[model samples]
Target: MLYKLWRSFIKEIFLLKRDIGGIVIIFVMPLLLIITITLIQDSTFRNLEGAKIPIIFIDNDHSEVSQNIKKELEGSKTFRLLTNFNEKTAQDAVFSGEYQMAIVIPENLTKDLNANVDSKVQTIVSSFGLEADSAQAQKKAPKAKELHLYFDPATNAGFKSSVMNSVNKMVFEIENKKIYKAFQEQLGTTEDIEENKNLISFKEITPLKGEKEIIPNSVQHNVPAWTLFAIFFIVVPLSINLVKEKSQGTSVRARISPTPYFVHILGKTFTYLIICIIQFLLMVAVGVFLFPYFNLPAFDVSGNMLSLIVVTLFAGLAAIGFGILLGTLAETQEQSAPFGATSVVVLAAIGGIWVPVFLMPEFMQHIAGFSPMNWGLNAYYDIILRHSSISQVSKELFLLFLFYIAMVAISIFYERKQNAV
Candidate 1:
């Protein structure tokens, strides 16, 4: 039995080696896919982080409040604040979509704010009977100052909300400082409390099991995701090869021989599993060595190498199992070729290969759980990004194993049923 299986394996290796197109499809094509996608996504990340949003700042007030707002915008380094345009021109530009948004600080904003704070402070002093000259306490509060924001019609709601929230917070802080200053003057106690900007702050942390604090980058993200895709893409060639065997009487000779059909299947699966591992190594090599030449981030494979290899093996098994099942179920090249290609694509789509599962709609995210690719992807992510130990990624790994077992079982059952007929 061992000799038979070894011969079968040797035959598969020789046949695949001679098929130049198959080698290219499994190896060269995947490398190109990963490189191209990583480059594109890296540029997108740079644009999102480093691109300055140009916003029109129409400072009709031209006072401390407007100037402070301008200072804040400039300090953020997020906006290229253009203050030259007047109300009419800025409004026109924003409405016409030449600019994403505009901020128009109302005129006399400082004066109105100061007057309102003074009147309120006087009222407080007079009510408390703490001051002799409290006649100004009766002065009515100035009408509410209006700060106008104009947005381009093409702007998304997310950008609009972010701009509005930032502006509101800034203006609210300025107003509070003014009120605090009034109280300080009325009480005759002097200390600067208004400039306390860092009184509160926020931070985000991505916890990893390892000490290395590598920033997540496009290459790290794309390499694993597309590697999973390329692994599963083996279904196409595997299924076609099976159909071709039947057409060319290869299956007939194997069946009439003393060797069992299952040995042939095992040999094919083993041969292609080796191919999957090689493909995986090629992708990682490109990310680690070649990407730096392109000025892209290098892939961080700093986690447990054993865990990474374990996950890759399970994922390869799952892909190879599905390929064998597809080949067994399909009868003709015409049927197998299109069906295998289309199935891999559809699986990739729903499996968080094309997009992250969290970004999908709720129902689609739930559906992703059924895809074997998703299970493999999650396992890969755990090992690569989270630095997860084998125990930590056991659930996804178990699911992949079960999927592989299920596919192989179904294929064996169908093959037996057909043979009995």
Candidate 2:
């Protein structure tokens, strides 16, 4: 019985039936999609480099502290500071796309800074995750004052590199004696030091070993997440393939064989599941070996690789079950293809498959929690981003395991319903 089931599973996979174009659609198309979408996102982000994000600075206090703050804006690479103008005109510029951010230093700014008070910086940023055109129009009218940043979160490396460069430039202007004296006071050192010793101490302020790891937030977060998203689109074409088999009378013929219905489905699923694994490895290879700047941290290749592979395979199985359920319900591939594909695509967007959910709106984050992609991503996040132990991912693992069970149940019910007809 075991040998028969195994042979039947193998037969279902080879299809023993021929459709050259169907194989191409199932296997080849997903590869193209992964490549195309990755390229498009890369190009779009690169294009944003040329965008001129304007910034208006309002200095209500005409003091040196206010002037120094203005100088800070002048020194920043993210903002092109506009001249001081009335509140109405400054606000109007944000609407006109002449500025994307506005900073207003209140009349008490100098006093606050001098007194070392923790005063709030009144920053007028564009609304949260709104469309640019809408933001532009709303800026013309009075919108709630929300603090938006001119530095693009999508582009900036958490302002780390830029900040380091700015520090290098600013250091030339700083009084070296002030820092040394402060250090001496903190260390309880003698007030007088030899001239040669002072010179040597000045040169010793270079960066310490491994200090470069201090700041993060770069393309690393986006690249792996988005690459997996493109791979997830594979469910669409694979679902269409299954639907085609049904319409063509192939599935019925296979079902009547000695094989159990589940075994037959498993074979076709395994083929595409293997496809996903290959694509995942390809993306990982490109990320770690090809692009250092965009690379994800090296994955654990020890015992963890096998567990990771199993986790990823279960995710593919869930997708396959969803595909089959959709395929069996629809009368034709034309109807089923769009239904499955559109649903996955939309779910991917909501599930933080493209961008981190933390970066999205609170509502969207809540919505993403309902998606299987979110569980898969969270699993990946635990392993890759947080460097979690297997035990540490218990919550994500349990949720995904439950999702797999639910999908299998649904697939079984859908299959029985289809067979009844």
Candidate 3:
């Protein structure tokens, strides 16, 4: 049985060696994919964090409130304000996609803001028995004040949300400061109340491993993701080859041989699984060694190398099982190749490879939970980013192993049924 499996593996290897294109797809293309995608994403992250987003800012109020807003926005170091164009020009620019969005401060904003604050202050003072005249305390409020935000049609919801939140927070702070000053004035206070800058501070933290703090960058997140992409991509060639063998009568010849059917399955699974491991290693190597040359952060799996390999092995088996299932189910190269490739892409899309599952809609996120690729990716994240132990990643590993079993079982059942017929 061992010799039979060895012979089957040798046959598969020989056939693979003859197909130069398959070798390129298995190795070269995945390397290119990881490199290209990591570089693009890394640059985007750097730009978002380090490079200032240009925003067309129009301060129509030309007063303390608007000026303070401008000062706060600039101080955040997240935005680079463009104050050159008028509202019309800025709107046109934003619409034309020259900029992301435009902020238009309503005219008399300072005056309106002051009026609203003063009315509230007067009402509060009268409540405290400070005001002698009830008529004076009932200060008439101004008209509804509007702050206009003109966004580009192409702006994503996240960008719009971020802009709105930043602007609103600044406006809220300004209004509160004005009210505080009024309160002090009304009470005959001498010293201005010092604002508590650290009243509500936020610090983003990623999971830490004993002594090492992992600041996740593109390379660390992407290597495992695209590696799984490349692993599952083997389905295309694996399925097509199975169809080719059937078309060329190879499966018929193998069926009548002394070797058991499991040998053939094992043969292909081992061959492809080895290829998957190689693909993963190459991707990690590129991330660790080549990324620094391009000024990108290095991928570090120092403490979790064993865990990474264990998770990757299970992921490889899952991918191999899927490939075999596709190969067995598909009847022709035309049927297998395109379907295999499309299914991989679809899986990648919903599996948190193309987009993070957290970024998806609620329904899509639930659906992503079922994707085998998602299980594998989460396992990879555990080992590399989260530095989790094998026991910690057992759930994902179990899910991946279960997926592999299900795929292989379905393929075997279908094959046995067809043979009986």
Winner by TM-score: 3
Model 1, runs deviating above 4 Å: 84-97, 123-127, 132-146, 150-157, 194-198, 205-212
- Two-way lDDT contest, 1 vs 2, winner: 1
* Tens-digit lDDT string for candidate 3 (209-249): 67767577888888999999998888888887888888888
Candidate 1, pairs of clashing residues = none
Error of 2 at 126 (Å): 47
- Per-residue lDDT of 205 in model 3: 72
List runs of model 2 lying over 4 Å from the truth: 1-54, 57-65, 84-92, 102-219, 292-304, 359-364
Best by lDDT: 3
Clashing pairs in 2: 125-148
Count backbone overlaps in model 2: 1
- Candidate 3 residue-wise lDDT at 296: 91
Clashes (N, CA, C under 3 Å) per candidate: 0, 1, 0
- All candidates' lDDT scores? 0.86, 0.58, 0.87
